[model samples]
Target: MSAKTNEPFTEEQWLKFVQQKQLKFVECQDCHKMSVIPFAVCTTCGSRNITWKQASGQGSIYTYTITAVPPPELQAIAPYVAGVVELQEGLRINGIITGVENVNSYPADLVGKTVSIEFLELDRKSILAFRLNA
Candidate 1:
């Protein structure tokens, strides 16, 4: 008997996409506008000539807030920092800021501070995060 093989290509592709730290953005060949999320066709000019490009992985802290009350599963890790970081390439994503011991000590003037990408493990999955670029 032959063994049956099944694998979700899209999911696997997405996993690899995230694991490799490859930031893909859709660039319209016609309008020359880049979008963070990939699309089959460009939303700006309705062009299908969009291509994916890698980002520099550098950004700034747009905004952030601290969460003290986490869900039951995350209760042990309460008092975490979450924020939306605006990438230098013009993409904004929400992620946790690691490497900080005290939330109160977090600098409020982080809006223009440089940051870089970092990954963390949660529930057996890798999550994209950011860290101060000291």
Candidate 2:
């Protein structure tokens, strides 16, 4: 997402993160707790110690759902697929899945299939998406 959103609720840092085309996650320096959300304190230990690390962007589809009737904002891109991806880093993050041509149709075997990062433009926002690793 871009920092120039007409909507005021989106965080600027998240926009910057996408603009950079880098997938990064946070880890507590004190306890090594990992999370995708950027936070000042560790969600596990409540410690202020935190560090950021780039993700490999390599993962597999842990679970997924093909939305046939998307929300109004995404009606233009309806029948899209969203999924919970399990990264090789041992973190699961929600992301869009691309390359599925048929909206009303979907793959029968997406679970455990390899995926790589692919960015797509949505609502003037740069979003992180996943696709077949090949």
Candidate 3:
């Protein structure tokens, strides 16, 4: 997998959002439904006319997994957690889980737990990540 927004997330446009320090999501122009994952059409209205909106970046860990075998690009930061965060806007997006050096430091379980945004800066590029919320 790549840090650059995956398929359907449209790299150029998605990166623009990330660079702007905004968590962007698609909102159906017709139905006004939000979708964090990029798609060919709105899941609700099946409309192609959708616009990007800035999300509040507050969410909960829908689910998570710690990667013991880090990818080559992130070997230095091995054993990281990655998961889908369900934002306050009612959409879920994938992001790396941060602010933990290991798996056993949680005060509570991650699933359904609250989280906040923490942009990870790597090699002059900014990427979306998360940390446990207070």
Candidate 4:
């Protein structure tokens, strides 16, 4: 079943959508700009007219960095790739890059590589991630 919400979405809501496989982003009705980050007012044009739109789960890696040493809480997934992805809608969002053969030594040609949204189980909770497209 599809999910729906009236209130402005937060990180928690976004995570829920990821778990449900129904990722969504906010689009400003005034400026027509979109953002994966939830906000009560549009950041682009200061408009309150915003609507939620379904994400296509397709994007290209804008940039990335390999986290060789993560925080104490994220030690389980150390040496992970994290980066911003430019979605099909032209908006960028931050997500973990999964399906890497070797986190410690990732390929140099990762920028602009195609990726698809995915849900990963970490610490017994589902989190949003992006898988490299074949």
- In lDDT terms, which candidate is top? 4
Native-vs-model 1 lDDT?
Answer: 0.67
Clash count for each candidate, listed in order shown: 0, 0, 0, 0
Candidate 1, 13-99: lDDT as tens digits:
445666765554556677888766556566677776655556677888898777887777556556877778898878887877765
* lDDT per residue as tens, model 4, 1-134: 11354445566776677777677887878899877777667778898777778999899999998998898866888888898989888888888898777676667769999999997787776767899998
Candidate 2 regions off by >4 Å?
1-12, 101-103
Q: Over 4 Å off in model 3, which ranges?
A: 1-11, 37-49, 104-108
All candidates in order of lDDT, best leading: 4, 2, 3, 1
Winner of 2 and 3 under TM-score: 2
C-alpha local distance difference test of each model? 0.67, 0.78, 0.76, 0.80
Q: Clash number for model 2?
A: 0
Per-candidate TM vs. native?
Answer: 0.76, 0.80, 0.77, 0.79
Residue 123 displacement (Å), model 4? 1.8
Error of 4 at 126 (Å): 1.9
Question: Ten residues in a row with the worst lDDT in model 2?
Answer: 1-10
Show the lowest summed lDDT stretch of 10 residues, model 1.
Answer: 1-10
